[model samples]
Target: MRVALFTTCLADTLYPNTLRATVRLLERLGCEVAFPEEQTCCGQMHYNTGYREHARSLARRHNEVFHGYQAVIAPSGSCVGMVSELYPGLAGTPAPTYELTEFLVDVLEVTDVGAYFPHRVTYHPTCHSLRMLGVGTRPHQLLAAVRGLDLIPLPESESCCGFGGTFALKNADTSTAMLADKMRQVLGTGAEVVSAGDNSCLMHIGGGLSRLHSGVRPVHLAEILASTEEDPWLPETR
Candidate 1:
């Protein structure tokens, strides 16, 4: 199948490897992936911040940029949620979009993508992916099928990491408190890595973990699923 990669703004700017891994994973599964260069922010910030007109403009742009693809996949669930859930009202018709895990399990119909990651990893279901996209257990199913990955269950896996885009900035104290709780649970899992579908949430959690000097690494689900013995994903310096 031919797919268009919707590299969300956070992944494009801060987590390029996640996008690369997503492409690699899809290709390994016999998909032809294309990156539409004209794609930009999904205007989720504007929409969530009460700028409906600006959000609608970008929504129309998104429809135009990714018009002809068979499937549109993004690494971040937050952005996908914006497009799939809100675009219908903002733009006339919404593009067919799926989060990475959603596309992998539902569209591809394969849990074992021939990956191998021999580390204790826990998954955090971001608010958008969980509530908005309802990608329950798909990520877990994929991680379980990996060759050597030890998928640890995160305590309170569904709790928000306190990075609801502008929510972190506007409610700094509440966000930090929630993040502290999240970090504590992640640390309690004794997992070397904490994985999630959204880099924005990872960035928020990773920032707190870094400040605490905790060694728990925040990895994207695509990066983990993209790993194989032939070309193992080496952790970048945090």
Candidate 2:
């Protein structure tokens, strides 16, 4: 498939490796991936923060940038949800959009992309991916198929990670409370690393973990899925 990558703003700016890993994983799976350089934020932040007009404007741009692709894929569940579920109402029609994991498991129909990560990793399902996109169990299925991965069940795996884009800024106290509880659950799993499809959530949870000086680190799902025995992310490096 000729896939156009919509590397979300967060991944592009703060987590470039996740974007790179998504590209690498798709390429390894025999996909002809193209980077739509004109693609920018999916206007999720604007839409969620009562800036409908701005978001609609961005939605138009999003449609234009990814106009002719067979599929528009992104590593962010929230961004994908905004495009696939919400964009049509804002703009006229959106390009066919798929979250990276969803495209991998559903479109490509492959769980084991030859990934090997020998570490205890627990997955946190972001709200948009789980509730909005309905990407249920696909991520776990893929994680289970990894060669040396130890996929542990995260406590309250389906709960929100408190990174609802502008929701955090609007309700900082509530957001912090939710994040605190999430950090507790992540640490409870005793996993060396926590992985999720959305970097925004990881960034929020990871900030709390960092402040607490916890040993566990946050990793993007694509980075873990992209890992191979020949090019493994060593435990010590994290």
Top candidate when judged by TM-score against the true structure = 1
Error of 1 at 123 (Å): 0.7
Model 2, range 50-128, lDDT digits (tens) per residue? 8999999999999999898899899999889999998889997888899988998899999888999989999999998
For candidate 1, give the lDDT.
Answer: 0.93
lDDT of 1 by residue, 45-111 (tens): 9998899999999999999999988999999889999999999999977668999999989999999
Instruction: For residue 24, give model 1's deviation from the true position in Å.
Output: 0.5
Model 1 pairs whose backbones collide = none
Off by over 4 Å in 1: none
Q: Count the backbone clashes (under 3 Å) in each candidate.
A: 0, 0
What does the lDDT read for residue 58 in candidate 1?
97
